[model samples]
Target: MSTLARWLLALFGWKVIYVPPPAPKAVLIFYPHTSNWDFFIGILTRSVVRLPARYAAKDTLFRWPFGWIFAKLGGVPVNRRERTGLVNQLAEEFKRHESFYLVITPEGTRRATSSIKSGFYRLTMLAGVPLGCAFIDYSRREIGVLGYLNLTGNQAEDLTNIVKLYAGRRGKHPTQEGRLVFAAESARSGD
Candidate 1:
């Protein structure tokens, strides 16, 4: 099914707009992840771009016949409710792997939030890797990595730059005011 999706996307001329030279070993950040279609578009984007990216899904999604399919499509099962420290686990995974690229949705949900979660930032920092921005703009029919940046741990300033980069850019999903709100909060909190 994954291969079929890739082939179909290719036949339709769905291509990557831009990809960084010497793709860095890092986590890929996807924003406004709000629907199931985001998965299909993301897969198509990865296939078209030939990017080795993986995304986290719920543990329940890993069960049954679909389990193999999801695994083949680079879906990593995550128990969101568990008390385990996910950043630590991801950092360990990065440490063990020479080249790892994981896709994370900063929104963390299909519904809108007033603030974006800081997990992706923390994970990238802990793993000592850069962060690449990926997006699916339905209106433009493009799915690709826009750019990469080194996080300086100044959440406020860093997020300001990121938001500016992605602003006015349509995504496969919708963005709530949360990202902007969080950016402001981070500035105030000095996080």
Candidate 2:
């Protein structure tokens, strides 16, 4: 574990309660990403679990000194505003790399929203990889990996089952709501 990650663990008193499947290729999904602290807890969880997971962030944040640090910490910068397709770009990245664990937030933001972006499902489908669930429960100061969800191109059914698995999990971020909220809403909207 990196020093920053160790410091975070000490500061937050985080503990991983679940161990995910040992998959070579997978997309890890995180919920209720409503604050910057979500990333902090995520870093600690990843380090404690000893997983070589990578996450995407806005391109602008990868500047100079900070960029160097992010790269060392396994950050993949994505151009969110680019007119080019995102799924294709991520698919290509996945194809280029022999093994990688990409982390994505289904909610896509910290604020309360009624729906989840389909990029996570689309990325896994295009890359032909499974989905892993990473969750943080602030109420319990617990962070866990909820195994893997093998995608079968049936977005509605697959997501429903996945969300049901994490039905009562709470969000670590303050502004964002619980995972159940987004999961239930996603199921209702069929997104």
Candidate 3:
């Protein structure tokens, strides 16, 4: 699998800068998710790095004949309609596991958005896990973890540091890249 991933990535002029996760249990953020291609690129990178990470998706995506395929690929069903205590439930799941990497795309969409959703940040903080800053830079044809941050409960300062890690990184569609600011940040500041 690793060899295949390497060949596929290098065949397309992409390079993987393997930065191991800071902890066995973590919440990884992959930013600048502006294209459908990001999923394939992420899968390739995951295989190359041998990252045993699971991604969350809508509950409906986990049904039918193809559901097993998604499960095989590390998909965790998320009931977006009923998010009450979801974070805590996931946190408990994390505690039950010896190694778990919950990969989240905080932007939560492919279109340009003014602010990010706060679920990733909240889950990371509540779960007491490092937030791994994973990135895909179209400008550099690179994909890897930049670093891990143990976020302070202060959302603003913590978010500022996360944003800085992504400096100079470009998404496949640079114009559609989502901003790092969360809506909660604005609400707190009365913006």
Winning candidate number (lDDT): 3
Question: Clashing pairs in model 2?
Answer: 34-110
Q: Which residue pairs clash in candidate 1?
A: 114-178
lDDT (tens digit, per residue) of candidate 2 on 1-191: 55676677768677677666566778888875767888877887788667888998777779985888777878888776765588788888888988888998777667776677778888999898888888777777777687788888876688788878776777765556634334555577675
Better by lDDT, candidate 3 or 2:
3
lDDT of 3 by residue, 43-160 (tens): 8899999989998766777899778877888988888776577788888888899999988888888888878888898889888999999999999999988999999999889998
State TM-scores per candidate: 0.84, 0.83, 0.92
Lowest-sum lDDT 10-residue window in model 1 = 172-181
Each model's lDDT comes to 0.75, 0.76, 0.87
What's model 2's TM-score?
0.83
Q: How many pairs of residues in model 3 come into backbone collision?
A: 0
* Candidate 1: tens digits of C-alpha lDDT, residues 77-139: 877777578888988988888778999888776676767777789998888888888866665
Runs of candidate 2 with Cα error greater than 4 angstroms are 2-11, 173-175, 178-191
Best by TM-score: 3
Q: What is the C-alpha RMSD of each candidate to the true structure, in Å?
A: 3.5, 3.3, 1.8
